[model samples]
Target chain A: MRLRIIKAYFLKEMIELIRTKMIMMPYLMPLLIVILFGYGIKMQVTGVRTLILDNDNSQISRKMILKFEHSKYFTTTVKNMSEKDALREIKKANIDAIIIIPSSFEKNSLKGIKTEIGVFIDASFPSRSTTISNYIQGVVMDLANDFNINSSGMININTRNLFNQALRDEEMIVPGLIGMVLLISPAILTALIIAKEKEEGTIFNFYSSPVSKGEFLVAKLSAIFFLVSIAIFVIFLVASYLFDLPFRGSFFLFWLASEFYVFTALGFGLLVSIIASSQIVAIIVTLMLTIIPAFMYSGMIMPISSMSGDAFITAHIYPVMYYNHIIYDTFLIGQGFNSPTNISYLLLLFGYGIVLFLLGLLFLKKEIK
Target chain B: MKIFITILLKELISFFRSFGLVILVIYFFTAEVYVAANGMEIEAKNVAVGVVDKSAGGMSKKILSNLHSPEFQTPKFYKSQKELSDAIYNKNIMVGMIFDEQFEKDYYKKLNPTINILIDSTTASQSLMAIGYIQNILMKFNNLELPVALKMHKLFNQNADTGLFMGVSELLSVITLLTTILTAIAFVKEKESGTWDIMLLMPVNPKIIILAKSLSQIIIIMIGVVLSVGLILFQSLDVPINGNLLHFFILTFFYVATTAGIGLFIAAVSKNIMQISQLSIVIMMPIIFLSGAWTPIYAMHPLLQYLSALSPLSYYIEGCESIFFRGTSFVDLLPYFGGVLILGVILYWYGFRKIGKLF
Candidate 1:
């Protein structure tokens, strides 16, 4: 438990980290993920390419095709290919959907009869196909209402989108990316430290020395935690500036919360490394334990509330879930820091950190014996 | 040929002796199967919304009543807009809606009265779909008369099984990642332990050694693929692979072969296991992103769509999806097979050349 020994170990780790460029590698990950997910990974489904085949070729059918063309969701074109060719292209995934207006479409609609419009969707990707189908339905309904306007009752519903008016995927994606990247980088950075030492036959130095396991673990954790926190702070600034992210919460509270989250993640990493016999096992285990859960159970992309039984239970146990919730709250919701629920979740996150570090200390002692 | 067989046997023995590698292989399969079965769903269902109705009129009531389950939970009534906003801020509800005082009056007068929706945009995709639901409910409430009926025919996946799509795509991605990583690790592990130089000193050709190593890795990866596809995806998850089974495996072989070449190239470049792991992420990220496994290529910018051609995964995902969903025959899948084959040959040549220099 010597302070001098711990500080020396901390400095040694810092020098190694700098020499290996490990510290610099993590910094790149957050930025790459932010830009890639922000610009490249578009969740909003738009510009779905659709082919419209018209058997009727009537003025009414042309009007229907025009409605689809005008939609923001669909980029529609009237392809004059035969049904077989259209099906081939659809199977080849050249087209997302095909709309066929029946031969008696105009006559039936003019006679005030219900006309069945055929919409064939390539449903390989379910969500996209569902969106395309929904868009088609909306357009068809709009056309139907237009035809029966004199006898129908239609109310224009003006919908107002609050907070994120544009609903930029970046706004939401950036914050979640911050949560995921911060957790994973710190955990992995700390995870390989002890395992690397053992693999290189350097652990015998510590075993022969007077530095206690607690002190050794603390020294390593603090160094990696410090590097990771600084990296996260820099990433936060870059994300805020680069993506124009709104920072409405108190900066101090956000920073404090981030520290606790990083400690918890690093502690988990230390725990994994302490038990792992080899660097490969440590890395693969850390990756599987942290990255998958961080992506899936942390509610980064999918809301925890929406998860079913097995996944929902898993989410509640992981510390990443609480951290992800805190990030979303502090970044987007901007509720005051003193809120009881917010405090409770943050406490739970700190609790996980303390428990994990203590567990790692206990295991290291047993391994020494 | 005797030297190749000897090298291949040694590689296989080392791989089998490592219990950690076996566990990791098992972990990858089971975890993917679990996530694909349970996760990969983004559809908003039973979303609880807070409502503030100032109008208290027939139209407002009708809209509220129309909100039903599988999409919306029973709406909780709020005393005022402040309460609704607080609930949303606290995450007690995903969304908050406020109906204006002139709701029914404006509707009858053909003056559009706005319904304000405050969404927690952190759940981005769900919020977007929630908007769709609100719009659809409004459309239903508005157009009570007969409209032109739309008959939707979902050609491939009729029920729109998201799990099936996610499971199958994940299977391919996992196979690609595992084969590449394990092969790279195997190559570097020997170098790190000082056995690579010994092997290099042998009279065996470097090409033979490389092929032997890749062959061992390919065999193991193929077994994992079969177990994942057969036990997990097809049987456990009930994902129907509609294509010819033989054609799919042939395509998978080419895909895995291309990755092995890429892995060998990485091994030649890296100095240690740590470096290999780091480089793996660097190499794998771009492939996964551009592969259209998670996001559709049609959704990407045209430039990205073109750039995706450089990644063999892009062809693999498309070809696999076509085979699984559309049941397209082998000859029709010539383009995908050729893409993987060409990339494999090029990378294999480059990697072998680099290894020759390393020795």
Candidate 2:
């Protein structure tokens, strides 16, 4: 664990990485992920292509149809088609939903008789369908209010979205995407680099030399960690400027937590490299471990609190969830070290880093098996 | 023909020889699908909510009581707005409610009472769904009886269970990823291990060799898909197959072939396994994003929506969902088939030519 040995190994690792042209991966991967997901993945389903069959053709039905057209959630086209044709359009996967206003709608509404407007939705994806259904109901409710049909109570709920004022999907997605990119790139880069040494028999140099295991592992981890940190910093700057993401919390605190997270990722990569027999196996194993959990359990798309049973436990096990919490709190909630919960998550991330690195050192054999 | 058979057999035997890869494939097809399907919940469930009801023992209590389990946790009673806001900031609660002292009086006097809802919208999907649920609950307290009622018929999936959808979607994504990686690695492995010259020196046609290698990996992937569909989708998750099973498999074969074409291109460019993985993610992420597996195509921007037509995956996902959920007929499935085939031929030809030049 001498300083000279560590520095020499670190420089060697850096030069080798640059020589192989693998250094570009950390920078390129985050840029690609940010561009792809930031612009591409949207939770808010808008511009729902809809077809309307106004069988009534009355002024009241026309006004009702106009409400659907005005709502941002739905883009409706009033066509002179039967219900059968509208449904056929839905089956072709051409349209998202169909609104059928019956032939006798105006007559019944004027007489205070309850009129039923049929809303057939394509519920293949339940979450999207539910949002569409809610939107339709909201439009219908507005129409009811317009008609002065006072059917329900007078309670008005004013929802104030707290953290993200506009409720922009990018505000939530970008922070989580940062966590995901950090996890995947560092882990994969370290794992593959180390596994490449093993595959090419370059690892025997370390085994045959006077370098200790702790010093060897630390030098490799730190060198890759330095590269990953710069890449993530560039990503942070680009994402903040591009998405107009507000940094509500302390930059130093966020930087510190991110470093811990990067260490955890690199250590996991080290563990994978130790166990993998070849470069191909190492890459696949790293992907299988990182990509799935990052998407599923990290609370990026799904909320951990709402998850039940094994999923909840699994989310707790991954360090990505902890980092996700820190990113959301600092970026969205604008909270820093003041909150006890935030501190605990930061500490947990630190603990994950130490544990993973220790595990890597424990597994790294001085001699070939 | 004899040469193609021999090469195909050689590829299959070598694939089986790699014990780690075999186990990786099996785990991906089985355990991976099961965990993702059972765990991922898109709909709101057990949302943590906090409440400060100043107008106690009146309609406020009744409204507060309506927030129950499954949709929400029993609302934690906080002392004031300050405490509740702190709870939200601490990430202790997702949604907070404040009912002022005038709530009950305002309701009785027909003076539209407003209940302030403080929501942490960082988790967009959950918060949005929770808002819808709260609105539905509050509708019970509304007095006006509208003359017109809207009846919603949720077609295909009646209950709107996300498990069924996620399970199948996960399976489809897994199929895409594995097909591309396996095919790319098959060729890249030869180059990495210094066997490329020997492979080129063989008397067999390069086309036959390429066809045989890719076909072997595709067969392996088909087996993985069958295992996933049987063990995870059908047996555990109960994803209903509404249309003919043969139609789904045929569609899957076309998709696998198209993706393998992309893999061929990746192998032609990369010198080793590291580049294969990196390049795979670079190429695959955009395809997956455009495919509407994670996000629906209709939800994308107009420019991206048009671009999705170039991605073969978009058609595959739509075609599969139609067969499984919409029960679309084979004749009606022609457009999807056409989309995949047209794209597959172009991509396959390009990749085939790129690698064939090396031989």
Can you list each candidate's DockQ?
A: 0.54, 0.72
Model 2, B10-79: lDDT tens per residue?
Answer: 9999999988779988988998888777777778889989999888457888887898888998888899
Interface RMSD, one decimal, each candidate: 2.9, 1.8
How would you encode candidate 1's per-residue C-alpha lDDT over A189-241 as one tens digit per residue? 77788888888878888888878888888898898888777887887887788
Question: Every model's Cα RMSD, please?
Answer: 2.6, 1.7
Where's the lowest-lDDT run of ten residues in candidate 2 chain B?
B139-148
Specify the highest-TM-score model's number: 2
The sequence of per-residue lDDT tens digits that candidate 1 reaches over residues B129-218 is 887888877866564556477888998899888888888888887888888898898889989999988988988777788889998999
Reference A-B contact fraction recovered by candidate 1: 0.57
- TM-score versus the correct structure, for each prediction: 0.94, 0.97
Summed backbone clashes in each candidate are: 0, 12
Worst 10 residues of 2 chain A by lDDT: A144-153
